[model samples]
Target: MEKWLVVLGIWAMCAACAVLFIRGATAGSDRRASVREGARAASRGSAGDTRAALND
Candidate 1:
């Protein structure tokens, strides 16, 4: 019974780690997309004109 408890604890830690890794990966992609969009908006000179920026 003691060995089983240890095995369960190890598995729980592994699952937690996997969840965190997946969440981090997803957030990283979102940050990359946001940066790309920001760059495009900056290059188009939307900052100079408020009318040109629809989402802002």
Candidate 2:
């Protein structure tokens, strides 16, 4: 029983770490996209910038 509890705790910690890492990765990508879009807008003198613009 003790061994099982320890294993479960370790697994929970690993899962939590994975979730946090994935969230961070997604947010970083979003920030990069926003920056790219902002740059394009500034370059083109457009008032509106979007993620799709960066993607293109």
Candidate 3:
């Protein structure tokens, strides 16, 4: 029983770490995309749109 509990705890920890890593990875990609878009908008001189994109 004790061994099973330890195994369960380890599995839970691994699952939690995986979830956090995936979330971070996705968020990073999203941020990169937002920055790229914002830059493009700024370059195009769309003042209002660029402000919104950069704010993201």
Candidate 4:
């Protein structure tokens, strides 16, 4: 009985983790993409500036 309880508890934990993982993966994806795009744009702009400065 104790072993079974332990097994059930572990299973429930795993299920909860899976649910959270799915929710997290699906949630805020659009926001993440926007943020990623912004970061890439900023980096490109800065990189160009730095390269031009270095050449001069």
Instruction: Give me the overall lDDT of model 3.
Output: 0.94
Worst 10 residues of 4 by lDDT: 22-31
lDDT by residue (tens digit), candidate 3, 1-56: 99999999999999999999999999999999999998997787877777899999
Superposing all C-alpha atoms, what RMSD in Å does each candidate have to the true structure? Answer: 7.1, 9.3, 9.1, 5.4
Q: What TM-score number comes out for model 4?
A: 0.53
Query: What ordering of candidates by lDDT runs from best to worst?
Result: 4, 3, 1, 2
Q: After superposition, how far is residue 33 of candidate 1 from its true place, in Å?
A: 0.5
RMSD after Cα superposition, model 2: 9.3
lDDT of 4 by residue, 1-56 (tens): 99999999999999999999989888879789999999999999999999999999
lDDT score for candidate 1 against the true structure: 0.91
Give the range where candidate 3 is weakest over 10 consecutive residues by summed lDDT.
Answer: 41-50
Model 2 global lDDT (CA atoms, 0 to 1): 0.89
**TM-score of model 2 (CA atoms):** 0.75
- lDDT tens per residue, model 2, 1-56: 99999999999999999999999999999999999998987977653455557867
- Worst 10-residue lDDT window for candidate 1 reads 46-55
Model 4 residue runs over 4 Å out of place are 33-56
* Candidate 1 off by > 4 Å: 46-56
